[model samples]
Target: MVTTTGVLFIVAAVVLFFFWIYGIVSFYFDLRYRFLPAVREHLRDDEQQARPDPEEYL
Candidate 1:
């Protein structure tokens, strides 16, 4: 027979597991949709700016 404390512990474990899954999914989507694009754009812009003037470097 399950006691009240056991039931509470099981419930808390289930709740925390659900929250952990939720956080992982949220972070995955956020990084895929928003953060990566912004970073790629910044890197592309920096690469363009870093090219030396043809007259100065050649």
Candidate 2:
């Protein structure tokens, strides 16, 4: 005999597994394609380096 609660649990687990996979893939793509480029551009900017290092104040 199939219990309704057991079926519901299985369905929920499958849905959550898909969500976990989607999160991982999206994060990986965002980091590789978007986040890294932005970071590189920011770091390479001359204006940032021209500013006095905040650590010097310490």
Candidate 3:
């Protein structure tokens, strides 16, 4: 009842679906580990700005 092309297409689709799922999982982890820390650091404003020496301008 099944054709060779149909089986091949089903296998290809399943492999592609798994790859898509893996990509989504990896992207989620990347944001959780790397992006969140960067966002927190950017939000914190406790550091003082550096003042240039007046003699340098003269």
Indicate which candidate wins on lDDT: 1
- C-alpha lDDT score of every prediction, in listed order: 0.98, 0.95, 0.85
Q: After superposition, how far is residue 8 of candidate 2 from its true place, in Å?
A: 1.0
Better of 1 and 2 by TM-score: 1
> Of models 2 and 3, which has the larger lDDT?
2
Candidate 3 backbone collisions, by pair: none
Candidate 2 clashes between residue pairs 3 or more apart in a chain or in different chains: none
What lDDT does candidate 3 reach at residue 31?
A: 98
Supply candidate 2's per-residue lDDT for 15. Answer: 100
Q: Can you give the lDDT of residue 8 in candidate 2?
A: 100
Ranking by lDDT: 1, 2, 3
Cα lDDT tens digits, model 3, 1-58, are: 9999999999999999999999999999999999988887766633322555678899
On residues 1-58, what C-alpha lDDT tens digit does candidate 2 reach at each position?
Answer: 8999999999999999999999999999999999999989988886788899989999
List TM-scores for all candidates, in order.
0.76, 0.66, 0.72
Clash counts for the predictions, in order? 0, 0, 0
- Candidate 2 Cα misplacement greater than 4 A, ranges: 47-58
Worst 10 residues of 3 by lDDT: 44-53
